[model samples]
Structure formats: C-alpha cells, structure tokens
Target: MVFPRPRPPERSDPASCGTHRACRSCWRDPGALPQGHGRIRRYAAGADLAAQGEPPADILTLIEGWLLLSALLSDGRRQILHIVVPGDVVVPLLVGSAGFGIQAATDATVCAMPVAAATTSPTAHPAGLHVLMKAMSRNAAMAYEHLTAVGRRTARERVALLLVELYYRCRRAAIPDHAVQIPLTQGVLADALGLTAVHVNRTLKTLRADGLVAYEGGMLRILDPDRLAAAACFDVEAAGAWLGPCPPGPPTPVPPTAPMPPGASR
Candidate 1:
C-alpha cells in the first residue's frame, strides 16, 4: 500500500514525540539522524499494519495511538497478544509463516523504517546500538511477561495487572497524570486478557466499586494505585527495571524462549 510522505518530527522533546523510550533515547543520540529516517504513515482504526504470513519488510514504530498484535485461530477466533502504544517498535522476526499480525486499535501514525536501514544505521554509534539493544531486550521481557499473565493469572488479576502496567507505561512516557486514556473497548480488553467481554465488564465493575479505579468516557482513573497494584500483585521493581536505572535486585527469571509471535520478536 502507498503511504503519504513523511511528516517532520515533533520539535518538542524528541523522546516525547513517540511511545518507545528506546526509540526516544536513540533519537536523542548525538549521531541520531537530524530529520530522522523513515516514512511516517497514518493508519485508520482497524487497519492492518502488518499481516500474518506476509513477508516481512519494514520495522514499524508507533508514533501515535494504539495497535494490537494478535493471532487468528483456525476457527477464526482472534487472540490478542499485546497492545502497542507510541514508541513501541513493531519488528518482524518469524519466517515461513507469520504467527501474529498488527492491527491499528485506533487511528494512528507509525514510522516505518526499512529493516536493512534500521539494522545498519546504528552500527557506527555505540550509544545508538546500546539503545536499540535495550529496546529489543525490554520488548522480549514484556512478551514473556504477557505470556505468563495469559497462561497463569486469574481473570481479575489479569485485568488489574494490565491496567497497572498501562498506567506505569504512560508515566514512563512522561505523561504525568493519575488518569490514563484507554482507547480500548471491553471486547478488545477481553481479547487481550483472554476473557470474555462480559467477564471483563464484571471485573471492571468490581474494580470501580472497590474504589480502586474509575472508568468513564474512555478514560481510566487510578483512584488507588497502591491498592490496584496490590490486587494485581504487580512487581513494580521488576516491571520498571526496563524503563530506567533502578536499584539492582535478583535478575528477573527469563521466560523460556518460545516460537516467535508477531509482536514478540522484531
């Protein structure tokens, strides 16, 4: 598909321009491209950014809005793997047949860099390579965490943990607020959490009644972040370690490697 000509990068804080902290850090490097290198494309909600089973071509970074990485069952059921927010890089890693696909969850913009360029551009700069490697590592860590949540967490815990995770991820993006804008419907949440929409609705209601969170008009207010975290049993230290410098602790046990899923490797 033909994309529009790229737009100029936002003039404000470079890191603040997108969602991925690693992408932002790389942008801040002295050797970073002055105008940035990539084609920025706008996608309508529900558009396919990358299709499963298609040959990989470019690495995409969300510049605005949300995307969903998902897989389709033979019976046509959709299993959402993860949500992609701004600055999240979408890389293609699986060969032969794609295991997942990327769909825009909302009207969005993404920067598309040719895989060849994305790989070779950072070779001359140690800082750029470091940032890129960290980003990839963090992405893998998060994928493992998602797998764990899907495989083991209870319905309530899964929903709560997702909220907590999003809250902190937004905070890491420098969005300073107690409220988070969740551009997902209950159905989407259900798909991501491996629960039915009714179950998700019930869980959310319970959270609201407990005064742990408030969801209204597409915004989620964390009324009691501490209580919410407690409910989800969120590991704050481990989760936030990938974001920035923190006191060292025992390393987070690496989740066993599995076949590459669409969003898991890039």
Candidate 2:
C-alpha cells in the first residue's frame, strides 16, 4: 500500500527539539536547507511506517521512540527482524520485497526524505547521505549481532544479549541514567528472540532471581551489567563503531532550521 506523506507542523529549531545526534549530524549547514526538502512527521504507537512488499519510496530517520522491523509468516505469525531506536534509519530497499514491515513500537517522530535526495550527489544534501550511510552500516552490524543471538545462543543468552545491546545503545545515545524503558512486552520479546512468550518470561524470571536484571513498572534495569555482559558474551565496546562518538553530557541543542520530510502512518 502506498502511503501519503503528511505536512509537518511548524516547530522551533530541530536542535532545540533534542533530536538524535545522528539526525543533527545529517545537516551540513544547520542554517541552510535545500529547496523542497522533506518534513518531519509524528506517529502514534502501533502505526505502520512501511509495509512489506511495497515499492520503496522514502528513507526514514527515527528521531524519537522505538520501531520494529518485522515479517509476517503465511500462518500469520510475526518475526521481528530488528529493534530500531532513535538515531536509526529505515531504508526499505535494504530489505526489499522480502516481506519486512516497519512499525512503531511506541509513539514516534521521524524525518523522511526522498531516496533520491539521500542517494544523489553528496554535495547536494551535504552530510545527509553520509549520515545515512553510517546509520545503514550500524544497522547491518546490529543485524549480524542479532543473527548470532538467534541462531546460536540459548534462550537465556538471547535475552541477556538483547539487554546488553540496549544498555550500550542507550548509553551511547546519552539517555541519562543507566536504567532503560524497554517498551517491549513479553510477546514482542519472544518474537524478536525466537522464543515463546512463556519461555521469555521464565528466562527473565531467572535473570531477576540472579540479580542480573530487573523488569518492573515498564522499566528494565541492569542490576549487574558486568555479569549480564559475561552471560551474553557481549563486548559493548567492540559491538560496532559506526555510531559516531556520543555527545558528552545532555544532548547539545542545535540551532533551529527548516524541517525535513514527512513519514507514513498506519
């Protein structure tokens, strides 16, 4: 199904909005913008950003919230391919018509731009294509990590690896404290980890009992990150370097400029 892009709402500077550093980095000149650039659009929880089998249109950069790239089976079962956090980009052509769908895991804000604009001359959009390339590389690295988790690791290890991944990602994003809001239910977790929801619950319970992690009130806390990393065999620093240096301290506010592109809604 083809989706229409919505008009962006007038807003203050993109930098002031505390957008992801990846998004801010895409702008070569924060003070100037190309003519007819895309606009930002917001999606409520459960919205579909892109559907499987649809022709590719725009490239989406997540500015806020979490998104899931998933595929549905013939029997109506869904397998989540990836958890897309802020600072990530969704390029439909990468997965092509392999039946992958992009959906918001939470209320999300994204910037969509024409694929041509992003792939055209780098001189035209400046850092836009460069940042997109880096984001794509990072996504590929994450995919490889997920493959190892699902194809070889035990269920407990799978869960541990996921938590470790999120912990480091949040830290790199400078999301304040060590605690993270998982924003995923047991069912979703099961799908992502290729386990049954019951199994996911059991593994989480075991982790809690071991004082390695805590999941309560919609928050997931790593009580012993060191132990959790050991269990998952995850090296936070060695995961990938495609995600450029995370800004120290709070998110540095950028000067406001024209908005980017509009994303699709479910």
Candidate 3:
C-alpha cells in the first residue's frame, strides 16, 4: 500500500500532540505554533532524501515511516548511522556534519521548509526547539554508542545491543506482540555495526539460540529482554533519555582481562 501525505492533525486528532505530551517526537498538529507547517514531500523506499553530496536547503521533518541516515566514505563505503521514524526532524546537512545523507528506508512523508524561514518563523514554538535539541542530543549519543560498539564489542554483543536499541526506539510506535518492525536488511546492519553481512547473520543466529532475540518476517522479537540487556551490557535508561545520555562513568574491568605480558616480543 502506498503511504500518502498526512493531513494536518487537528486538536482532536491523535497526531495533534502537545509540546511536552508528544514524548519527544516532532510532527504533530501541523501549522500550529512551535511545529511550523510546510509543504509535504513524499519519498519512496530506497529513495535518497538527501543525496551523498547534495543536501537540500530546507528542513524535512518526518510525518511517517522510517529514514536511514548515512555517510559515505571516500573509499565508497557507506555507514548507516541512524534509523529514524515519524515525528523526527531530519535534514541531509546536519549541523557540523559533511558527507552525511538521508534515504528513505520505507515509504515516507515529510513536512519541508526553507532553513531561513524555519528558523525565523513568528511562531518560534518551544516544541520545535525541543525537537531540535532532543534529536541532536540523542543522535550524538547514538553515534558515540555505535563507535563504542564497533570498537569494543564482540560481534554478538554488537548485534544484540543494536537490536535492543531498536526495540526501545520502536516502543513508542508500539511493539505489538513483543515484536518490533525492522525494515533493514542484514547488509544495512553490517554497515551500521562495521561488520560483514556474514558476521551479522551468524551473530543473529547466536542471539536466537541464546533466546535473547530473534528476527523473522521483518519483525524482531525480544524473547528475553532482561537477559538480552545483560548480554549486551545495555543501559536502557541512558539509551532513551530525553536529556541525552548521562556523562559516562570511568571504566573498570568487569569480567577482567589480563594486561599484556611484560617484555613480550613486539
């Protein structure tokens, strides 16, 4: 089925959310103060919302479906940095970021406005500012989390943590029957986690065997949320915090690793 541009949600519509009541999501009560209204744009799945080197001068806020925020390396490698859903403010040229692009992971609609107008609108609503602030904070934390996962986590741990993250992110969208929708392919997972598709596949298999999580038919089921979090060392609160993750604590050996042998041959 094709997704169409959403109608402006009136006060009675569920989509018409209050500033704080919207739970940090962006689009709601279109044309209302704080959530400036704009022209609606629709994108098909796999369509580039923002091309690798060309970013639109206007801001595009999601009205529905998922988006893949990515960056392309000079060597032609792509890194899937974030997967965003409805009520998220997204633009290709994120502040201080170059080489980043956004693609539609599923059919989507967005409310678009020019940068200058969006910033200087008479209805400079706090909700709009909240959306911008929270999105930046959360996205930055996510990038840092991904960096840690890629650098220090095992393949299985990385996959588990990623799944756990998605589980929580989709909770707001509803996890019907313990399952969350995941439209991404293993290749996307591989790019996100800095692993090969084979590695992601094998790690997912291990997660299934461990009864932590399992994926099938575009859904990921968390069979054991507690156990899965333990395996991933996931800090759920930090992951979902609206004010952004807490300042990280100093590290210590948990399972404890031995230091490199003294005077070992280089």
> Residue-wise lDDT of candidate 2 within 1-266, one digit each (tens)?
43323223334233221243444544544432333445576787887777666667777767778899898776678899988877666776744553687888888877776676556634345555565666678778888888989999999999988876765565555445323455777778889999987887778778878988654434455677668978888776676585344344335332111111111011
Model 1 spans > 4 angstroms off: 1-26, 30-36, 94-97, 121-126, 177-179, 216-219, 243-266
- What is the descending lDDT order? 2, 1, 3
lDDT (Cα) of model 1: 0.64
Return the TM-score for each candidate structure: 0.76, 0.77, 0.72
- Badly placed stretches (over 4 Å) of model 2 are 1-22, 25-35, 94-98, 121-123, 177-179, 215-218, 242-266
lDDT of 1 by residue, 1-266 (tens): 32222233233232222344445543566554323545667777877777776666667777778889888777677889878876666766735645777888888877776665556654334554565577678778888887888899988889888877775665454333222365777778878888987777778778878998654434455676567878988777767765442222224311111112112112
Strongest candidate by TM-score: 2
Choose the strongest candidate by lDDT: 2
Q: Supply candidate 1's per-residue lDDT for 114.
A: 62
lDDT of each: 0.64, 0.66, 0.60
What residue pairs are clashing in model 3? Answer: 26-87, 34-125
RMSD of 3: 11.4
Model 3 TM-score, all chains together = 0.72
